[model samples]
Target: MAKKPLSAWPWENLGSFKYAMYGPLAANVMYSWIYEDSYKHPWCVHILIICALRGFMHQLWNSYNNMLFLGNCRIKQQGVEFKQIDNEWDWDNFILLQGLLATMACLMFPSMDDEFPIWNTKGFITLMLLHVMVSEPLYYWMHRFFHGRYLFTHYHSLHHSSSVPHPFTAGHATFLEHLILSMVIGIPIMGSILMGSGSTSMIYGYVLGFDFMRCMGHSNVEVIHGAIFNKLPFLRYLIYTPTYHSLHHSDMGTNFCLFMPLFDAMWNTLNRNSWQLHNKITSNSGENGRVPDFVFLAHIVDVMSAMHIPFVNRSFASIPFSTRMFLLPFWPVTLMILLMMWAWSKTFLHTFYNLQGRLYQTWVVPRFGFQYFLPFAADGINKKIEEAILKADRMGVKVISLAALNKNEALNGGGTMFVNKHPQLKVRVCHGNTLTAAVIVNEILKDVKEVFLTGSTSKLGRAIALYLCRRRIRVLMLTSSTERFQKIQKEAPADTQNYLVHVTKYQAAQNCKTWIAGKWITPWEQSWAPSGTHFHQFVVPPILASRRDCTYGDLAAMRLPEDVEGLGSCEYKLERGVVHACHAGGAVHQLEGWPHHEIGPIDVDRIDLVWEAALKHGFRPVFQP
Candidate 1:
């Protein structure tokens, strides 16, 4: 590791408030437009707009490159980790700083007069010419110079910190490096303006194009088709691909050119295997794509959560899921994404991680939480789930764990539908409900002899009731179905069957301080419980904290193994590295190499077994405190 220099931006510690750096420049532009009536001199306003455009363009690339469906095109197979995400979180800081500097430069240069038009072909050509002559060679040398011992150790090393480059990784640099970059980028634009060839469109085009190219190079995903280089041959020297720049990060000695490989070739600094490696990745996207040891079949929660996936926004997804005011404006865009998914999308890989040397991935079905209840949407959702299972089976995946709504009993019978349909599946289909049951039951304190249980007719509920009754603990089963209650009661021995008491109303559990709610309880129902009663729930969208005195535990979840790697994003509302019990259950099954499918009803005898297995594999329960 190189020693970091004290080149941090003054505003670096300000966090998101660092965006306020744009306030002075934006106010100046707005003042000129309103009070000063300087309509012709729109240069200041254009600077602000260009900054906004570049920021948007950079985010688009970031989102697209991290998309799991497009993973095959990725230059690096390993996933981005939390450390890299933290390093790049402030990537947009450069945009604000550069915008400020550019605005000041416009004020300084008298040649940048108030006479601006919509477009200028001459200005566009001039900017390109300047970029090739000045920006290209100057940046190539500066980039190479930074790689030298002193500069690399003190400055350029920050930019190379991301082993797997993301789009924002391009902007992640020391203050001194960005200052140099601003000068290199500004020269071409300023040259066009100084030569009287500058226009509004040319400035926008050049700056946005510059950002686009930078993002493309750092995107990790190789989007440029091999045929493009093959057809032209000369384009290889004229342009650089994602693979070209990625090679620079990995090897650090070659492919130093900014946007064009022409300079690298001239200096003999280009990586010789760049083209061959690019083709290998792009061609690996078909039937013989890479396989994983375990697959977690996940689904969308709702409209608000659709954009919370790792590919959509790394910063947003890295934290616990929440509704952001900034994201509200993008709701229409999210709705469009949903419509597209409803129309053509299928099960696609959303993210993945490594645990104990095994490759584990999360493949998401294109259905939202509400869709799973639409009755009409059941078959469609199930079809997507089945397709994902069959695909995993074909890919030689060891285990496929159905998550959340994907394993709903009414929708797919807890993944039993797929396993029974394809009995010869080499890949085991798992609902992970056994571990879910284990987590819920284990949540009960050992000394508690009596408790209230809701949704007692459900699979997990039945398992919990049977398990508790065998321990001589009284489980007051809250259910309207006597037949369902009797069936579960019979599963226990006659000596303990009396411990499984069925209750028709919430009033029956008034004296019990421990409440296990598998179903959503209304305030009136919750009120029936005495004060200080704790609510441990497995209900989706865990019931709200309605009573101040009563405690509420989050949904059943387990912290992933401490050895888990590349877990960059949070799993829903749970804390980082913590996943729903069902997801962990699948992981344990894969680690233990359980031969049989864990679908349908959970076996009561296996509850303790799964719990012990999870602990053995380093999975811990989410501590309540």
Candidate 2:
């Protein structure tokens, strides 16, 4: 397994401390302002500023952890280019709606004044405490409702989309979920205003405290309870630690109570044994046993399948994209069309021989050539990568790795390698890339698990390795080749380290055959060649076939403009099953040769061979295409 380099500063700890210290400071300032003027506006302003500042700082910390630490951590455990499926819902819209509603509610409320009834000292404290009480149960109940079979599919599903939650992911939810949830906080404040039960100052304090506590609960950092507090059973009831909150995210049913566990304990819902239960479930099934795939599939069918009716069903065939826009005004139809076209042009057409030839001749090539190298250069393990690794692990597959030597080294002997000493399971480091290294990996991993490819290697090795990976064979890469190694590491998924085994080596026959034996089975149940350059060529058919299947429909659906308004007479058409820009404005050109050609079947054998080689060496392979 590989360790990803840290990319962000440690801001979460600092922000927490700053909030703790500055909160009292701001409160004191508010007290002084209120006393001097006997006016409530200044106090209200101070409270808002302090709360806003704390929220901002808290988010900054969260962003760093979610985007950098957690993101990298997941990649190290998983592979690059992975996606997770938890539930079906739109969390982003949910969060946005909640934010909008909260903002509106705040705006609707009147400002605090000296004569405000809630401004008195006792009233202020009570309001703050009540806010906590109300918010906890409200959120808990709403969350539980979302888990319900009926509502889970339509409303609560979005939050679960991110099985492993990130910071920004915290608020991503559906609009309906947000609307209902926001009212829990909003209604209380609104009622206080309507009844004039206390001073506006008191109400404002409660809101501030409510927000601060929510942020604290959601923070990923672990905060151990004080020894004294832990020892005193009753005191422990009052303090909710970070670990307590994190459990709620991981396990669905337990830890519903927020701020205080008293309510949950009274109802026998307090998940005091949640940690043990979580461990038990994970050990038993290797996944949280909340929802099954069939259940998720059903939900997807119910929601997205219905969506397909708008296209596949005859009732919708006559409706053009423009007409559909009017009917579904909320959807950004124009933007979606434009984005789809743009993506198609970049992904498929740009790689098609005839299209590339036409595009290059039209001067589009020079402008975009620099962008082509960006994915290679800026490539590092990201969230998607981690998702890939986890997805593989869930399928009960094991990843094997190989490290390639530096470019300066000769392929046959100059390049060094490393191999995993252990055959299967756990993280280990090896030192070089060579035939001996490959032998070491084969010996270690023999009869242990699957294989994966990683590292800068021959196109043949890569093609073979990729095929294996796609077929659920665990193939990965590792490299000691300085620049190439770093690139591979960077391109690895966030969760790679947790699942992938790093090895060093190069020999395909002796190491691979001995280890594979009868255990090796191709995805399609076909035998693959283990020797010769033809093995490399064998990998290509699968790659091209799979890519063609994956992208053909998307390419065919693209709607291009017949002519550009400003650009001189040029017409666009699909020629020989490829997009071409022809002479209204420029010279017509045909592709002379294949564009970005790949050779070989990329089957299980190739992946097994390359992966064994990588693990023998200390490095992993670059999993990205």
Candidate with best TM-score: 1
Q: Per-residue alpha-carbon lDDT of model 2 for 207-309, expressed as tens digits?
A: 5555555555554433342344435768556656445566766666777675776666666766666444323433443232211110000001111122221
Against the reference, the lDDT scores of all candidates come to: 0.87, 0.34
Task: List RMSD in Å for every model shown.
Answer: 2.0, 22.9
Instruction: List model 1 lDDT by residue over 1-625, tens digit each.
Output: 5445557887876877877777876777777777885644566667778888998899899788877785447677778888899888889888987888887787787656676678888888999998999999999999989999989988888898887888999999988888888888899888888888888888788788889999999987888888888889999999899988998988889999989899999999999999998777777755334579999999988889988887788899999998889999989999898889778876777888999988899988878788888999888888999999999998899999998788888888898898889889999999999998889888888889999999898988888899989888999999999999999888899899999998999999999999999888988889988999989998886787889999989889999988898789988898889999999999999999999999988899999999999999999999543
Per-model TM values vs. the true structure = 0.96, 0.36
Question: Candidate 1 overall Cα lDDT vs. reference?
Answer: 0.87
Q: How many backbone overlaps does candidate 2 show?
A: 103
